[model samples]
Target: MAPQDRLTATFTRADRVAPTPLRSIPQLRVDGLSVSYGPHEVVTNVSFELGRGESLALIGESGSGKSTIARAVLRLLPSGGHATGRVAFDGQEVLGISERGFRPLRGRAIGFVPQDPANSLNPVRTIGAQAQEAAALLDEPDKAIRKQLILETFAQVGLDTPLRVYDSYPHQLSGGMLQRVLIGLAILPRPALLVADEPTSALDVTIQKRILDLLTRLQHDLKISLLLITHDLAIAAERADSLVVLKDGVIQEAGRTASVFSSPASAYAKKLRADVPALNPDRYAALRDTGFRSLKTGQAPKIEVSAVTKTFTVDGKALTAVDDLSFSVPAGTTHALVGESGSGKTTTVRLLLGLEGPDTGSISVAGEQITGRSPEALRTVWRHLQLVYQNPFTSLDPTWTIERLVREPLDRFKIGTRKERDERVREALANVGLGEHLLSRKPGALSGGQRQRVAIARSLVLKPDVIVLDEPTSALDVSVQAGIVEVLLSLQATLGLTYVFVSHDLALVRQLAHTVSVMHRGRIVEHGTVADIFDNPQQPYTRSLLASIPSGGNDVAHMRTRAFG
Candidate 1:
């Protein structure tokens, strides 16, 4: 449905009726909540009210205490954390209660959905064993009945193969499937309060939408009070009834989600609203305002894939990963390959980077063929081509100093002298907006954004002509993501860098790419300039991806695209 149609459907008479009788006392009330971890106070004077069956979002960047506040409410704070406040839940004081006293209400009444399902679920145990343990909260004495109920809940949460999921361990499933399992476990007992902490941050766009929609449906159908914790302002605007914007343990803005989106009072809130790619997709407009008009005609593209096909043999079965894929990226411009997971985005990138050889087609970089190249020959191509991974936390070596990490590429290539390499290291850091002060610092000593900047600097140290960004900003906070976007644009504008941005985020693609190829099931469904792709996508799959973008009722980007795109 169109945005207007969704609004109409939402405001229909049948949908206007309230689902549950709200309690006289608010479902939860936190009065002057201050959480201290040892000597430092992380969350201070936080206050919010969640009415029965209503959804509230605590939103902010990292270290903003959004999760801290949620943890305080649920009494799940880590060691040495203390809270000073009045927390009233169901007309009873829950502040500073004993672990024994809070046990009854923890999962039975107030369920929790933690972020990072990989870290949350037990690694060694099967899903059924872990789920059965969680189902104990239902107080169902019969084991077989509990097993049946778990399967039913699993299917309810949209796990297509509930039995298969039950029998499998965590590693056997994908990230999205594991997340659905976690949601199923959280909702098994039908708790009144559901606290989901960044549950869909790691998933791709379609899966994220499905998980969020499932949560909304579960909230309404069960009449459960919800507390959504996230950094994405657009998601909060679309999902929550009310929102509380936090910064450094302080409430920057608090009000209805629509009011907050329409009229954000605080500067931080306004910046966040503008940083959301869905709400403000023209983030890098000024840098790329001229578009691809300057690219001279008759010049070959920087990267080209001509009818590339890559198939891997798994369990004696040939799996075609990239199917007749072809796209050309002009020099000094970005060409995004947008698709969901397992849609051949990574496989195509691997083919381009010479990480994997194509089965039956040719790939080229800078007019040189990539397929059928030896490892020794591919090194020459790799020197002019580099890759930026999705997660910086793992891509960068934690033990290596930042300077060493960036300088390693130069060292491996043996491009410069001792003094020259030092100067080049500083130059790369300066290019990515880093300073010499962070040279000696380790990855653990830096923030997520800083780590990513370091990763970019390392990639740039080799002076590659082409860089393949693998969902570069998907893991960072919204503001941090905007900063990264700015850095990337600045680099592209200043250095005439060519980029193959691989991602599923269409909104970010609007801000980043000059041309795009929409891939689905290992095939490009639509291919065009960014303007044609975003303004008038022809394929149904492309349209569906565009529709899934959370507009937050802001059309500034679309309006700008008509003028410049």
Candidate 2:
């Protein structure tokens, strides 16, 4: 049978089996759970419970064992990983079950949505093929009926064109679309519990809100218990009924979301709350006031773009990626370009970096014309500008040690003697808050935040006047993001560095940017001071973006005022 037909048959069988109803017992009870790899324990004596139809959030920084606990509950751990704990669902023990015994409950009673859709999806298969295989797990004999159910589920999850989406490959879909596909597949079996692991972490804010809303609606409508794993404190506070904060593999705090946010008992929990950009807007605002030096009245801007436009051709069609874009960054202040995916933010950055020439207009870096410059000339200009990319893991060469990665820029630029180069690397690392002990380590040895610090160190070693940061802290935990932001602010203050910050996160943009430019559909729709844009947005698009930020009605503005007043 074809993939679509096979998928249909699978859902048809799932429909025949009625979903397990909520019982008197807790929906899920995890007691004294411990997960270890060899002799190294990661999750130690973790315990939590969820009542029927309730939602719980597992939150912490990277390697805090949030994902480990989730995987352990699902029996999804890899080889050499051992999980010992009492995990019960609806009064039945889930641990110590044979593979054959666990097979029936894997998808039928429990559903899982992984962190990265790209990682979880089969790159070689079409969307329909994967959906079909997942549905077939239901063991439905009727192919036609299963297909109908799958299509219906797709529509229910907001995929209006089920046929088109089903036929498309994973890469053909947007991150949001791919996320919905995963949700559709997860809910096809009508499982009693749904475990969403960082489901929206990789998406833009607007898409993240939509996905969260979708999950909320599904949980309510289906009466499904949800276990959400995330590093975002705001999301946990807004989405879950209860919150569990973990650090170093141990539970720091767990309680009702409102109660925890209002009066967090643990220092770690309090730190997590304070680190959230949305929760503590004044923290960054204060840094801007106290630390930042004012620009000279008549000084030339560090970077300027005038009437820039860029276009690309796809399948014989010309598509404008950036249109008449113009913005300027002062000598030592941050200018943020905020937009959703496909809003031309990346194209604008490429234009600024001279990675691509504009079809029209001009770009100037450190008051030097760069647009249409020869490679040799631009190479000279590149010494004054550098880019810190979104993902440090991918950007840093894994084969090279930290010392080599930091020194590569100095070596490439041929600046100073060997001793001087080594000193520069050490100075850069210190500026980013990394110690010399990490110098001998590779990218694989560092944490997510540490890897990013190394990336910043490499950029700083060049002593560039302007650093274009592309979503630098988007992948980090709330606390880690706060630390990175502090480092950036400190470096900017002490070194007089200019930054062109590009991000989809409006909250972070509001915190760091002196000037803000809102981009939509390859055009700058709004531009103003951060205060004017955030406090009193003029454009409809800008207002819409601000309104889309997920707030669990926590009165964040009031919280900020009270805390920072």
Candidate 3:
């Protein structure tokens, strides 16, 4: 069937299935929601109705103004962004409401959960204080009542040891834990509406599922309306009741999740879904039988770590980050170090790159034990190993241009002269699907995906024997991720380079890695072929990880329940 006809059919099915809109009442009404930032109109004529306890997903690529429309609903536009549309919540005109009146409606009647928890939370204040503050905002004047409310709220979000977590600061908790705290605070007031913008993007697959399940439970039990803002259509399809596809501030398609996913109505929607990268069966078949076996002949050890371990002392208490972890990457092969946060994945990579010293174990590169080496000794080995970090924003120097950023690594290694380095930088940029025009722009000027490509370009300039990709695609969109993966594959083929990929994204890992290593806490609980790990994982932890991956094949329909008024 034609893409447009299919999308229309899907949307038509949703319209037929959904109950007719009540003339008297709608939980939230956004009519001709237009938003502009100075000279540019970010979102134009956006309209949607969210009934009581209904979920509406706002999905699009980066810079598509999905977030803008979401923020406009709360009148929380970024500085200089103006809105010219009627946003009514619970029959009240929200955009027309006074600041004093809006204050009560914001946290009590409607709650917001931003994308990044680090930015949402206060680093210095304890989580208890934050939770208490959230409860206090509800006008529960009594001290005892507030304390009881906060503790109960924390418990509702599945936070284990509420007392301990309350006492701990934001920095002390992991991303998943912090997200739970955010959920606790948002739901403390029992708000009618909850707007979550990419709430689980920073989390691992397991944590993402836990958060999704928690949100689903909350929506049903509390009868809360949800407006989920995300770039992931898979997440939207798996969680939302209604899906609204947006591109360049325009609505491309809107319908029930199942209808839109099974058969989209718009060309844009079809294109977007087609762009999502699924696991390649042929690649999986090739590596499914290759368990934790030794490398084949003519394979050079581009990156080798022999029994690496790391320990940290916090408040005089010792904690082991990694325990005698050993792995090797042969030339032209990709070795993935799969683990959750704090599993010592980053620490292991740091040691291999001579960025830090391991407490116990030696690291060998090209047959040389480079552990405990001097700065001079490390410099020679550093040229052979390059790293592409997870957060491209923090990795690239904001002050430098893309050209300078890509050229810095070459100059550091003294690979070539100024003109030669420039040529190599240009070549690297092209390899990553960027051009010389982007070279003049600073890291801040580029989009998230573009910034990451710049980081990749910089790493590729060295043409190292091994590249350590630390969650390279975690922060990017699926289409951008697919493009980046292609670039990495091409580089591997052309340069005969090896890769050590560290990521919490199981789907991405399964697509790229030859062998999978499932880590829990600080150790690998399972190491084997991708098929062995996915189809029949031995360890309970491994099985849990496998089960947690959000797939369309999973029984999500049963989990999706709309709350009634």
The lDDT, on a scale of 0 to 1, for candidate 2 is 0.87
Number of backbone collisions per candidate: 0, 4, 3
Please write out the lDDT profile of model 3 over residues 1-565, one tens digit for every residue: 5433332342232321224555346778899998999989989898988877788899988888888987888778879999998998877788977778888778877898889999999999998877777877656566665676676667888988777888999998899989999998998777788999999998988899899889988888877789999887778887888888999999999888889888998998887776554423343333322322324553666666777788989889999988878766766777788777777888778887888888988889877777878989888777877889998999999999999999988887788788898899999999888988998899999988889889988888887777889999988987778678777876665667778889988877777766667777778788866667877888888787777776654366665643332
Ranking by TM-score: 2, 1, 3
**Candidate 1 lDDT trough over 10 residues, lowest sum:** 556-565
Q: Locate the minimum summed-lDDT window of 10 residues in model 2.
A: 556-565
User: RMSD of model 1, in Å?
Assistant: 6.8
Candidate no. 1 TM-score = 0.93
Which portions of model 3 show Cα errors greater than 4 Å?
A: 1-24, 277-298, 561-565
Among all windows of 10 consecutive residues in model 3, the one with the lowest summed lDDT is 9-18
TM-score of each: 0.93, 0.93, 0.90
lDDT of each: 0.86, 0.87, 0.80
lDDT of 2 at 188: 89
Cα error, candidate 2, residue 555 (Å): 9.4
